[model samples]
Target: AAPAAAAAAVHEVTCSAPVNIAVIKYWGKRDTALVLPTNSSLSVTLSQDHLRSTTTVRCVAADEAGDRLWLNGKEESIAASKRLRNVLADARRLRRAAEAADPALPALAELPLRICSVNNFPTAAGLASSASGFACLTYALHTLYSLPLSVSEASRLARVGSGSACRSLFGGFVAWEMGQRDDGADSMAVQVASETHWPDMEALILVVSDARKDTGSTEGMQQTVETSTLLRERIASVVPRRMRQMTAAIHARDFDSFAELTMADSNQFHAVCLDTYPPIFYMNDISRAIIRLVTAYNRLFIKPVAAADAAGDSAPAATSRGYRAAYTYDAGPNAVLYLPREHVTEVLGLVNHFFPPPAAADHAEYFGRAASAFLPAVDPAKVAALAAQIGFAPFPAGSLQRIISTHVGDGPRVLARGHVESVSLLSATGL
Candidate 1:
């Protein structure tokens, strides 16, 4: 047995990773266990300040016991979670090489890890929660052992946990290229641009439902692969072309092409879901309403944006005429909107108008289901007034629960490592 001092000695690091919403959705998997996507995908990583997973990993001397993970204060068995096991194993494997190269490396890899992860946004709400969750865990592990793995290699480790997670390891725009090799060696995420490159890119996350997804991404995609014949044609023909267009759009900073391709790909992905046998409907009534609203909003600025693009800063109408925004969704009902910073106020104002605040009598609903479900930063007084004027727009109060406003952001970041004592999630309950 280890000494009491050694038992209490836990080396830990807290890492935060941003959530990524795929514009070119990775809906089907070629290899389930290996997590190889059927087609390549692209995404914009949201700012960590708004939606992220802050995971703290503690490594101490231990027996052959398995690793453990706790999310949002609830302990989850690591053994039962294959995704988690793969993530930890990848990090430890990389650490082994590092230890061989440097003898001074700590023996943290030999010990079991205690991981505590918390997310500011709802879990499994079609917002790519797993993307940030596993990315943050792997990052904490990489930092704890001080491994020298490249960003791409580290992202590969996260891909084993969630396909979309690979992109979370990078910031701004990311592309998860589905490698052709069966070994999946070349299959990894690549950054399209840094957060600093496109300073105006913004994300408006609409929380349609905060509840756990009725059908998880893995399960839903698995079913679609088996039942939907359309999935094959999409991987073979549709995604390849879409990926090219999206890549070009990002490189050129062409918001018009970016918006068109993003919305088109989203619609096609959902269309594939419907073409599946027994059919899967990831988008509900609320999700459809959001699509209509976003389309209407974009109409105001599309012509202006196009004119501006054609003129390239010469057009006077370009500055104020168009709405530089688009919306996309994943395997759930939630909506992720992409827009420029100049229009956030107007768009948010419209959002408030549609989903107004509840009456004072419904305080519990706001603090309870509404609170846990959404995080719209609008003033309650304003919402109450909007509710009176709109008289219930399409759905009820909780239908559009939260609105997360963020933008193109960098990848996993190490926050305040020097002040470890303060950032510790374990706090007084020290490991």
Candidate 2:
């Protein structure tokens, strides 16, 4: 829309990444400051449709005192913690060196980075915001700095922001190694398998509740670490066995084995959460209802299979022929269900039946107070029109907002076609 001369001078680079929810959860921390885990954890990266963060890092030399960050087009104050700043500084330094090494190199660090990020899904709803945020940040910084950091190295940097962020650096199935070193240099993530490797895998993300939790993971983990003796058994005994079994299941393409292990591990993680001193409550009524539905569905399907196999006089086939579904939950009310791709529509239908939209009268009754206060002088017809514009639909008379469905997907990637700009003095001089 502007002059060609103004447009040609600016260069932009955009990067995007998807969020992942851990099945074998990373609950405790060995080094809180470094965000190191006490034990290894595994997660599946979901498709960008269900949840994702898109970050654009454009460099410009402006007279600003410090870098700025924006989320969904609104300016946000950077977190007070210096971890992110340190990572950004390191990337900028590398960029500067790259510029110096080549006279033709464009200066990228001197330009102020206008970072605009948006989470397609809810933030702080226990849906892994750290996973997407840190992954997107790392990916953007690496590109902006012109650094040769591999995905592993970028993951290590992201780990400093949040323990699970490391896993988000990779696609599909990923494992975060809990390094022995206290410094956390060895703590990083490695991909187990690409989404292509397991073509039939599908994830159904049920958004049971979007309300922000009162206690953050940091505080909750600290409490559990200090008090829960059951957690000692979980970390020392239970998780290691489950981790090994899960790895084997993924490799062998054993859905039955995988489903059983995934659900059990999730339950154990929540069990440890409840055993904490004063008991931190992560799951709610809606979450339990989802669990009940999944369990009943599994039992209903498995019963028929068991009965059919048992009736046969010949030796029963060990492997499952029909589609299998498994449900796993994280720290919040959201449920991540893994199933065969063939059953996706069936799953969606079931989800929709459980959580329908609110009715028009119910919506009016619920929002009547706010509507009355805001539009006291407006016409009744106009008020109704305004309410419709706000996207207030009658959901099934319940608390749940909606379901977010996604499947396993790829990690962070660069978008070269977008606008780009140099951040330093050298680039401005066209050196």
Candidate 3:
């Protein structure tokens, strides 16, 4: 009998995608099925340290009945959802083209792929998991198949899974256009500025709240799409203007313009949330308190800077600059603060001060306090004391789980050569 063909060398490809927080948030979708956005949105891609997803896609020759995927070691049921399969199918179609002239294209079409993915940060703690997930998946597949698609084309495909996922396709400043097309072919992401373009910019992700959100973005957007008229005004007027301003801010490296647009867009998105008919609540007391702390800090320093400018006591040109800290939020309670890396330690120290972890004793007491009520219970007399002690405002002790710090980074990269590394293999016994 012919010796069994030497087991084909296992082929593997690894890719990574960074998490992105929207500055001009995409709340409602115009076409849910196509994952089209109601309005254009902008996002800043964080470094690998704060939030990211890495995926390895490998093809192996096997029975052609079905495909499989394993995420973080546990076998995932691809039948439960079509999202992963759709990505895999696209990859296989591209790989099949290479097989036309040669018989050894790794049999990608008949072979099942084993995919393993892991997120370095909290999955759904408002940290933009969908952004990283779809980005990693599409990137891994593209690498495995050697697809000849640009980042924009891949981003358009990623959007079918999640609206904001499209933005994760690039690093630094990115914008997802709400293209006026029926097929969604034109709706995709484009890079406004690469990370290298803004070398000093950094994003500090504050994990103010880690609890699973009550409303998934899908459900929340669907509700907003049907019930909110305010959404109409936002999509038609506010978002368009903000999109233009944000793009300009990124291009010119105007921190003042960037910060203003970022904060305003965030507030407006949350406002749209509150404007929903039944009222979807995303921010809690902790979120509001963080907002207040940031605003107060800006006001305190900004007023002084302005005064210094008027008195000619500071650098005239620099005095015209704005506050360094810019805040934005998504559908969850987490906050992304954009600042210069030179000030990262200082900003983080300030954030940790105002939002201290709740004392074990205070956790029960602060569970459901509203923004106004919670402020008084924190001991006004002790406010200064705590601020002095921590070097920033003191949050309810134990309120925060932990803080994740990251900066702007690249989109996806391929790490494996074809057919040389296998991610999985069936045993001879076929267990």
lDDT of 1: 0.77
Steric clash count of candidate 3: 13
Q: What's the alpha carbon RMSD for model 3?
A: 7.3
TM-score head-to-head 1 vs 3, winner: 1
Better candidate number, 2 or 3, judged by TM-score: 3
Candidate 1 segments exceeding 4 Å error: 1-10, 63-65, 304-323, 360-398, 416-419, 427-430
Tens-place lDDT digits, model 3, residues 1-431: 12244363445677778888888888987887778888888998877644678777666557634666666556779888666566666667666776675665545555766667778766788887878988888877776666678989878777886788889989889999989998888899999999888888877666777778989888898888888888898888878877876787787777766787789889988888888778888888777777876776565445443332221222223333547688888888877788876656555555645766555534433321111222223344434643544344455667776656567888776655543234222222211
Number of clashes recorded per candidate = 3, 18, 13
Stretches of model 3 off by over 4 angstroms after superposition: 1-7, 93-107, 303-319, 358-393, 418-431
Q: After superposition, how far is residue 51 of candidate 2 from its true place, in Å?
A: 2.1
With a 3 Å backbone cut-off (N, CA, C), the pairs that clash in candidate 1 are 301-322, 301-323, 375-402
For TM-score, the strongest prediction is: 1
Which one wins by lDDT: 1 or 3?
1
Displacement of the residue 129 alpha carbon in candidate 3, Å: 1.4
lDDT of 1 at 67: 71
Best lDDT goes to which candidate? 1
Candidate 2 lDDT, 336-369, residue by residue in tens: 8898877666555444445543544354333222
Question: How accurate locally, in lDDT, is each candidate?
Answer: 0.77, 0.71, 0.72
